[model samples]
Target: MKRPSAWHLVLAPLALLFALPLLWLLVSSVMTNAEINRFPPALIPSGIDLGGYRYVLGNALFPRWFVNSMIVSAVAVTANLAFGTLGGYAFARIRFAGSKLMLGMMLATMVIPFQLTMIPTFLVMKSLGLIDTLGALIIPSLVTPLAVFLFRQFFVSLPRELEEAAWIDGCGRLRILVSIVLPLARPALSTVAVLTFLSTWNDLTWPLIAINSDSNYTLQLGLTTFQGQHHTQWAAVMAGNVITVLPVLLGFLLAQKAFIRSLASTGLKG
Candidate 1:
């Protein structure tokens, strides 16, 4: 075999460094509690055990948390995509007073840290009696500034001639948007959908603050139940992390092609 170049040698180590933690998590998930708590961690378990997974899957509440997370993610993603697409279309195709100011203000909200607004948001949710309900989590994420900005940029890059042609054929703005632009904007829509889903799926802090009852806990927040001040179940914690992350990882894997295509196409237009 030919000798690999120095660039290949450098990249080989970098790739291993990035993947090592994930590889360790996979191995540790199958290890015994004793092995996980060993003075020096076992690089490889002597025997594979399903105890950790069994514990997690057997917990009746785990299933509920998983389902709640899905509900919040699904509802939030749908709202974001629907509103984001329409908002993007209106901002891109329609011209109205203070449009530039409004766009700038929306984008500015994206830069504001969530921490700054958490108290106010929580108060509002409390006032609306949405606290401790999944609605608290889903409602806030329904209109993400980032999703709106991305969709607007994507919409602006689309050719206006297609829309004008549709209009000339007696199609109204709503019909033209539905039949023409949305179909052509699939890649961008998919990109937004996947990103929104992942964000809502992995969300922990907001859900933690908004959700007070164990019955409405999300998967990510449920992981905290595995930790204790006196002793931590490292193996179970790792297992929960693995389970919590698997859906998101799988979702990205499924949508990666559409995401990359959208990024490439959007970049070209920008």
Candidate 2:
């Protein structure tokens, strides 16, 4: 059998170090309120208690909040992928007057912090009469500069031979993009989808600003209110956290390989 490398000696402990907090959260979720509040903070429970899970499931608004988050994330991810692909393809393949200046200006937006733009964005949403609705959340995130930049980079890296051959066969740009290029662009697609999903799913600040109605609240915003509503219920709070984080963790674990591959292929990994 092959021996393990020396790096394993350092990494094994670090892995445990990172996992410990998640482990404690899971443990605490199953503990009773009394167990959680005990002196020294009980690390193990005497018996399983489903009360935390019960509280969350039985709350009508919590489930509604989960659904709201799913709706916004699904729409945002789909929109970003579709439009980012089109805009990126244009930048990568088509020659247009002022294209370089336009691309540079678009990329420049990425450096400006969200803090500076938040008020202006809020004013725009208010002007459109989208405030207090899910539309406010979906409109702004339809596409992002990073998505366009990544797609442009990946599309540029593709060998022109493929597109040229398709061109010889009388295939138009759209047909080539849909039928030829996209098939080989899975790594970039996966990276974009996973990133857009994570960002949209975990977003709280925007939802907090846009959604004033209880029915429109996303899970993160709802959870913030949940904690305030039931401050003493540590177990329930931990349970809510687990529920909130589980989807993102599972999603990243499933797509991490493709995500990493996309980074390397696009020259961003370096």
Candidate 3:
């Protein structure tokens, strides 16, 4: 059997260091509030206490928040994948006047921080009467420059011969894209889907600004209500966080292979 290298020895502890918090969170979620607040926190609980999870799940507002987050995330992922893939395919395969210039302008927007555009986005949402609605959260994040860039790069790396062959078969551009190109672009599509889902699922800042009504709050925004000025519910907060993180973790685990493959292939081509 081959022996482990020095690099593994160096990295193992670092990996564990980063994993400790997640481990702690999982452990702490089952702990009592009293156990959590003890002078020296218990690494392991005396007994499993599921009160936090029970409370969160039983709460009337939590289910609504969960549903809202799911709706927004689903819409965001669908919109980003559909639009980003189309825009990316166009930039990769189609040649038009000022295409390069337009692509450059789109890429440049990525460098502009979200904070700079937040006010303008909020105002626009207000003007459209989307404020305090799920639309406020979903509209602004439907697609991103990064998703477009990833799709374009992956599309560029594909052989032109395949597309040309489809064209020779009398396939129109949209037909070629949907029938030939997208079927082979699974990795890129998976990467975009996973990324869009994660971003929309975890987004808190924009929702905070755009949504005022408690009923419309996303999971992240709803979780904030657990923290009070005088006392915070650590167990409930941790339980809520675990619930919030599970979907993203499960999503990545399912799509991680394609995500990595797409990123590696995109980077190599670039």
Candidate 4:
């Protein structure tokens, strides 16, 4: 028989410690309200009860909120991939006047806290008449500095020989990028898509500030309606959270390998 490693023994408990809350949430979701509030709490439910899920799914407003979230996330992910990749490629391969200065400025903006710019962003949205609309969420999240940086680094690592050969064959920059660069950048693209979708889907604070109408609320924002000053529905909240988290969880699982590879390689050259 093989002996267990010391590292495994050390990591086993830490893994479980991190997973305990998710396990408790799953267990509690299937317990009755009374049982959930019982003394000492129950790690295991006596019987499975899906009343919480039933309540959340049965509500008409929940579906609308879910659809709204889907729209925002999809749009943001598409825009991020398209624009971020284009900008990154330009920064990596093109030698234009002020290109380095512009790239440096964009990177610097990433360090400034979003809180300091929140008010200015809100005013810009108000000026564009996007407030109280899903556009308010999607427009601002279209691209991010991190996504651009990731793509730039990945592009910079690719051999210039491929692009040079394409140029010799009379391929324009755009054509070369579309035919050669993008296909080779699947890992970085997948990483950017998954990250953007997760961030947009889980965002609540900005949505709360921008959207006032319940009809315009995203999934995260609508979930807050379940809470009241006098009473809170814990079971419903947990169920809603599970539903909201499912898509992001599935996305990560599908792209886990590519996502990790992209992140690991992002700083390799730039």
C-alpha lDDT of all candidate models, in order:
0.84, 0.89, 0.86, 0.86
lDDT tens digits, residue span 1-270, model 3: 988798988899999999999988888888889987888988789998998898888887887899999999999999999999899999999999999998999999988998999999999999999999999998888889888999998899999998897798888888998998999988788888876787799988999999998899899899887545114567877888789888987776777787576557647845
On TM-score, who's better, 1 or 2? 2
Off by over 4 Å in 1: 38-41, 229-232, 257-270
> Pick by lDDT: which candidate is best?
2
Give the distance in Å from residue 45's predicted Cα in candidate 4 to where it truly belongs.
1.5
Residue-wise lDDT of candidate 4 within 1-270, one digit each (tens)? 988889988899999999898878777778777776767766678898898899889987888999999999999999999999999999999999999999999999888987998899999999999999999998889999988988998899999998998999899989988999999998788888877887899999899889989999999888777554113567767887788778877777787786566556555633
How well is each residue in 222-249 modelled by candidate 1, as lDDT tens digits?
Answer: 8776554213567666777789889978
For model 4 the local lDDT of residue 221 reads: 88
The runs of at least 3 residues in candidate 4 whose Cα sits more than 4 Å from the true structure, single-residue gaps closed, are: 6-8, 229-232, 261-270
In model 3, the worst 10-residue window by lDDT is: 225-234
Tens digits of per-residue lDDT for model 2, 167-228: 99899989988999899988788888887898999998999999998888999999999999
Ranking by TM-score: 2, 4, 3, 1
Clash pairs, candidate 3, are none
* Candidate 1 clashes between residue pairs 3 or more apart in a chain or in different chains: none
lDDT, residue 197, candidate 2: 90
Model 4 TM-score is: 0.90
lDDT of 3 at 117: 94
TM-score of 3: 0.90
Whole-model lDDT, candidate 3?
Answer: 0.86
